[model samples]
Target: MTDSIRHLSIHIDRTRDDVYAFASNPENLPAWALGLGGSIVREGDEWVASDAPMGRVTVAFVPPNDLGVLDHDVTLPDGEVFNNPLRVITDGTGSLVVFTLRRPAGATDAEFERDAEMVTADLARLKELLESA
Candidate 1:
């Protein structure tokens, strides 16, 4: 069975449009999503993260829309795919970014916690980058 879902969020002191514009761009993943390492490039229509922690991976995001959905699918080199649900919603004059992290099947408690920590750190990085800009 798969592990339970966990929702993590970070408040960015910026407009939703600004946040969404930055986060939705695949090229910007490396700047904030550290899990993708420090660089990502487009190969055909898909974004490729060649230095990802789990080796090279392909990320396919949803088409740009006004709904603030930033969902994407990451396919590992081993052919495993993970669907990631993410969004940037209005929060007063700023924005709130939420990421839904689901632990992979058969992951240990410690591993799940570690994944959460990594996501928290990534969101923190996003907040820092956007807020300071």
Candidate 2:
């Protein structure tokens, strides 16, 4: 029931566990997830992105698990919620990080493309950071 969905992926020269461990930590999000915000802090059970592009938002992540599922729900100040599907899977000796981006309802072509570009940049940043570590 969405306009479109795009699976953007990046191959990082790091183990799946290593990639997931770093990416799953909300504290490290600011280093790569620019689209999310410039910073995130845990407030009670949910992480709050005070400087998010869409303004202050609450990010609720799924419980940590061995499946490399990094799914999270981002709640905007207006109460609108966006579910982001993310996963890190083993790819040869490295990791393949995949982010599923769903186009917003009634979004224009340019908006969808911009979203995909942002996700791609974030993933690239993750790879660069992890590989350099």
Candidate 3:
């Protein structure tokens, strides 16, 4: 079970398919994911992001599909895996992008809030980029 989970979402002024197609692509990770954007390097079938505060980590995202699932698993240098549950749901004429942020054990309130803020920023960036495209 997770220590705690925060569900953060942002409404994107775009089709669910379009938002999912763009966000679900690993090649586009750095475009919105703040920290990994400049250092996520692809190696064969895997991805490695260098210069992470915790050292280099591997990232693997589920393939994009019609159901709008954008879940991904990131492997820390310590070999711990963090699962991120993300989805794009249709709402009226636009789409809502929801991201689940699981609080790690022993994480302070500040840490958790910072993470939530980061995800919020990332999603906002996604919304802005898509809406203006």
Whole-model lDDT values for every prediction: 0.94, 0.93, 0.86
Candidate 1 vs candidate 3: which has greater TM-score?
Answer: 1
Candidate 2 residue-wise lDDT, 23-86, digit = tens:
9999999999997788899989889999998899998889999999999998999999999999
Question: Model 1, poorest ten-residue lDDT window?
Answer: 1-10
Q: What digit string (tens of lDDT, one per residue) describes model 1 on residues 44-70?
A: 988999999999999999999999999
Deviating ranges (above 4 Å) for candidate 1: 1-3
How far off is model 2, as Cα RMSD?
A: 1.3
> How far off is model 3, as Cα RMSD?
1.8
| Model 1 TM-score, 2 decimals | 0.96
Could you give candidate 3's per-residue lDDT for residues 8-127 as a string of tens digits? 999988989889888877777777887564668888888888766678888888875789998889898889999999999997899999999999889998999999998899888888
